[model samples]
Every structure is written in C-alpha cells, then in structure tokens.
Target: MGFNGIRPNATRKEVLEMIAVIMRDDNDLEFKLDSMNLSLSISVVTEIFWVLNWERLSALRFFAWIRSSKCRRFDFEGAKKMLDEMRQMGCDPIVDTDNYLLSSLCRSDKTDESCQLLEEMQERNCLPNPLTFEILIYHLCRLGKFDLVHEFLDRMISNGLEPRLTTDAAFIKGYFNSLRYEEAHKYVVDSSV
Candidate 1:
C-alpha cells in the first residue's frame, strides 16, 4: 500500500523514482496509483504534477487522485513554485496545468490570486485556452463579480473564443441573484438584439 514499494517515509527523491515507475507503467497507472497508500505533501504533489505534465492522461489521473485523496490543499504559492521551477528547468507548464491551478484557486475562493496567476501566465507567454476564460468567468460570476466577469468575457471574445450559452446564462443568473432584476432583464433583452 506504499506506492507499490515506496516506503512510508520516502524522501522526495524516492517519490520521484516512484513517479518514474508510474510513468513507465502507463497502462497500469490508475491501478498502481489506486493501490498505493501515500499521503503526499503539497510540494511533492507539485513535483509529481510537473513530472506528469507532458503525459496528459497521467497528469489527469494524478490530478483526480490529488483531489480525492488526503493530500494537502494546493495553493497559489505551490502553483507559482511549480511554474517557476519549470521555467528554471528550461520549460513552461502547459495550458492544462495552468487551467488546473486556476480551477483550484477559484474553488478555494482565491479569485484574486487566480487573476494574478492569469496575468503571470500571460506574461510567461503561456496563452490561456478557452477553458481558462470559462473557469474565471464562471467563478467570478458566482461571486457576483460582474465587472471582472465582463472583463474576462471581453478578453475571451478578443481571443476568438465565443462564450458558451452556459456562460451567458451564468451572467444572467448572477445579475438575478444579486437582486439586479432590471439589469438582468436588460441583459436578456439586449443580448437578443
């Protein structure tokens, strides 16, 4: 139950070695990971996430594991560190990785931090995908941050991405929930035009 031979007190190096084994046995990744009884720290999870970045499926499975397991909560600092470490190693994290961080930040009610990270992602030339904008817009709308939501929506369109109908509904819902009935009505009317 120890990562398929990883000791309970395994160091970062050992955990990394285990990651290698997991990568090599890609077909059995879920089975191997599910069988392991490891409690990973934030830093270790970051490292493992970085290592799995290039392997989309593995990274996704690992991300799901991180979410469901008793692993430490991921924070903005951990995400920043992972990105910085990747840059130092002569690589940039993929957009999916950034999206994951954004989702995590938003779920934690750290929308401000997520916005900051979005800026950093742009500065690093890691252009965000449509999902990125959707994530931010959804969270911002939920928090009744219409100003930022509008801003992101504009940015999303400028990037040649159309806002999904769900996004439009979220905006309308946000206005309604905020007790701005007039604004919501106006929005629906104007959008129809």
Candidate 2:
C-alpha cells in the first residue's frame, strides 16, 4: 500500500511500504509517524525487521532510531503506570531505567514528582547515580529551587558522590540567572576553601 493508504490496521506489506517511503523521504521520521498516528510497539518493529530480511547491523540501526524517537516523547504518567505494572509482575527495572524516567520527569517540568520518585527509588534500595543527581540538580537550578538543590547536593556528597563540573556550572549559571550574585560568589569562595 502507498503512504496515504496506510492506516492503524495496515497489513504488514502496507507497513513495509510506509517504512520504505519514510526511509526514502529522509525527512522528519517522528513528524511523519506523528502525522500518521502510528503506534508501533517493539514487537511490531522487530517483526518489520525480520520481514524486510535486513542484515543485523541495519536492523540494529532501525531499532535504535525507533527507540530514540520514542524516548523523545515524555509521558510521565504512562511511564509511572508501566513501572507500577512491572513491579506488580515482580519485575523491577534496573537503576538506569529509573534514571531515564527521572530525567523524563525533570525534562517535563515535573521536578517535584521527580523528587518523590527519588524517595521512592531510595525506598526500593535503588541508589541514585551521579547522572540521576545531575538531572535533578540541573532542573531544580533552572527553577531557582536553591533549597532543594542544596539539600540534594548535601545528600549527594554524603553518599560520596562529588558533583561534576557541569553541576558546578549549573549552580553558577542558576544563581547568576536569579540575580543572586552574592550567593554565587560565596559558593565559589566556599568551594575554593
């Protein structure tokens, strides 16, 4: 089937044609997918790969592209629900998975929810890594939430995790953006000490 004829219930052959058209366009894949309202799952994607009879390397690239596209959309409630379901199935995701969700929450301006997730992570014995701390601190700084920033910084240090230079830069930029020059200067001086 041609691109215009493609629908939600399109046959495998039609989906293949749509994929071919998308690849040929070399334009915005996400936009095309969005316009088409295509809801492709991993299984369907893998099936497409097998049907295409592509080499392993090509299939890997396609899979990565699909995953990246999906990751660009932040659906916090959907993610949380999926996580809850995973837990119910006695299948806890790894720390990295939680970190990804945390990053998504932060990016979506749900920093407060992200903080609650951090607490949940702790309760689950899932220790937050440096990236997790960085994600929270960066977004909190953007919001000028210095109190929570400092609290997390202290907690990070207590856990023997030194902030990255990017973290330091975030603090400086955040304070300067908020016109808290004195605090920024003090932070610089104290760090030197």
Candidate 3:
C-alpha cells in the first residue's frame, strides 16, 4: 500500500497487516502476527524504514516531495510518529486489544486517526479475515443488539465478505446467549456445517 507517495511494495503478510489496520478488523491480524517471523519480515518494506529514520529536516523534505507529487497517497509518516510516541510511552509492538482504541476513535469521528491506525497495521503486517467481522457481529447479537448486528452484517455483505462455519456457530451461540432459542435452533439447522 503506497501510503505517502513512497510507492513501496508490501509482502503478502504486510498486505494482510495493512488491511487489518485500515479495516480495524482484528482476528486474522492477530493470528498472522503470532505466526510470522517479525525479525526478518521487518526489513521487507524499505520506505517505511526510511520513514522511521527521518530527522526533522528530512521529514520536511519528504513532505515537500509528497506535496509536489500528484498521486497524494495515504502516507505512513504521521502514523509512524504517533506509534513511535506511543511505544516510547510504553505501548507494546504486538497486536494488542489496546490497538482497538483506533475503533473508538473511529466511532467518535476521528476518521483520520482510525485510518492512520489501519495504515500502521498494514505497515506492520496484520491481516483481518472474515471471522474478524463475524466475531464483532456475534458479540453484538449475544447482547440482543440488532442495530449493531445489522450494521456489521450490512458492512460485511456490502464488502462482499461471507462468514465461515465457525462464525455461523458463533452467531448461533450469540442468539442462545440472548435467550432467542428458537432463532438459535433455526440457525443451527440452516448454518451447521
């Protein structure tokens, strides 16, 4: 993902991560992070390495280059800065639930920050999979919150994503949690693998 006119190519894992950051979808990102070799993978993207190494004057130079460039892509410098600051303040580098603060910032209308978080996730190599959205939707349904479920299901459908069997089970469980046994049983019949 060419954030900031840098035009760097991300690895498969990196593409997965960037998507996670952009979407704020967590499940697959976390799973991939645990399996990858972060040490070697870190070197896969050079522009990002340059972004982290920038001195103030160098950063200004980068900004000038981006402004003059017509592409005007999603850049990662600001994200690198904020993430670096957070790390200095003791945030862990791994994909922690704390990262979901990006979602809250999103819900509260901090669209830019949310996007920054997603970009950062991409830089680090997190992949958000279908189960990710399913997990969120299932939890909402467990609480009998149709509005939230409706919102996520719509988002998933509109995005052309579908849930897996395990995710279908989660929805059934969620319905059972909400004491909607009839509905849960109906889902069990239609959704069981």
Q: Of the candidates shown, which would achieve the greatest TM-score relative to the real structure?
A: 1
Colliding pairs, model 1: none
Between prediction 1 and prediction 2, which has the larger lDDT? 1
lDDT of 3 by residue, 1-193 (tens): 2433334444666644643442443445344433432321223323332433442122332222222221122223333444465455453344432244443443344445554554555565654446546655555565567566766666666767787777677677788777888987886786555
Q: TM-score each candidate.
A: 0.70, 0.65, 0.36
Please tell me which model should have the higher lDDT, number 2 or number 3: 2
Alpha-carbon local distance difference test for all models: 0.73, 0.71, 0.48
Ordered by TM-score, highest first, the candidates read: 1, 2, 3
- Candidate closest to the true structure, highest lDDT: 1
lDDT of 1: 0.73
| Pairwise lDDT winner, candidates 1 and 3 | 1
Please list the residue runs of candidate 2 whose C-alpha ends up more than 4 Å from where it truly belongs after superposition: 1-71, 87-91
